[model samples]
Target: MALKRKKAYESNIEKINGARMTIETQMMAIENANVNLETMGAMRAGAEAMKNIHGSMNIDKVDETMDDIRDQMDIANEISEAISRPVGVGDDLDEDELLNELEELEQEELDAKMLETPSPVVTAPNVPVHVPAARANEVEDDEEAELRALQASMAM
Candidate 1:
């Protein structure tokens, strides 16, 4: 009787395990279906956006706008070049004559400055000035004494 009861319990455990495996499989299938539905929804939204964008703009209009922008840029570049060009490039002026004229103008300015009257000078008050004593006589005396002392020391 004990052996029959043990066999029955083993059989029940096996059945329960099989049912758990089936439930897990069904759950995984439901999750996969949900992911598939979300992916389809995102794809549909992207398609609608693309259709709206295409409907708003034509290829010819885009090309014409780009061409106009390019033409404006070229015109701007030409105007810039014209403005930056050096002035007097085609003039026929003599460099020697210009230099002589500049020298004459400078000489005329110097002559005019020299002919102007000088400013009046300011005179100081009369006062007795104190003069410093001469140090040359002291230096001569020191040199003579130093030579005599050095000669005497050397002789000793």
Candidate 2:
């Protein structure tokens, strides 16, 4: 009876060991499948990135846009130079005519100013002098008269 009971316990231990081995093998296969799925997802993402890179760039359009930008920059530079240059800085002019006109205008302004200014009234000086009635007819001749006129002008 003891030998039969020992044999039955040994058989039961073997069955549990076999079941544990089978479960371990199945878990290993599941882990391997998950790793393969992750690898495939990485490869798909890489493929999508490559496709987007190829779609986004065009060599001919890029070159044309660069050339157009360079041409526009040249035009802008020319326009800026044209706008910055001084006007009437290098043309020939008639200086003599301009000076004559300036002088005429100055003379006219001086004449206008002289007309606007106030001047004192002209009157004879209040000098006391008496001449005899008979001698008043005797006028001084040209030489003495001219001398007196010159003296009067100098005194004035």
Candidate 3:
């Protein structure tokens, strides 16, 4: 009986994990769809502008297409805005603060992902190295030399 209960619990956990994975995948898809919708809106606007310039445009057709594009753009904007809406309670905070926090969170998440992935070790090019003439000829003035000496003495 105990073993059967354990097995059932494990199965339930697996189901929950699978559901979570599905939700994450769906959210990523939604983000991509939002981007595509915005691109589509821009393309429609460009096409409408071109049609107007060509002077072969049908007023009714243009109006209908613009309206449809506007509706779709609004829907995409709303979805994107909803996705970006803050999860925590902070009604009193200013917009800048909220934006800053969101930026920081995004940076931290990016950093975590970077830490997870191993970067490739790139070797320097095997070309002949040429030392710059300016660097080789550079000399420190008395004041700069004194400052460096002081710094070295202090370090010692």
Predictions ranked by TM-score, top down? 1, 2, 3
Residue pairs with backbone overlap in model 1:
none
Off by over 4 Å in 3: 53-156
Q: Give the candidate order by descending lDDT.
A: 3, 1, 2
Question: How much is 151 displaced in model 3, in angstroms?
Answer: 99
lDDT values, one for every candidate? 0.90, 0.89, 0.91
Q: After TM-score superposition, what is the CA distance of residue 127 in candidate 3 from its true location, in Å?
A: 75
TM-score of every model versus the real structure: 0.50, 0.36, 0.30
Number of the top candidate by TM-score? 1
**How high a TM-score does candidate 2 get?**
0.36
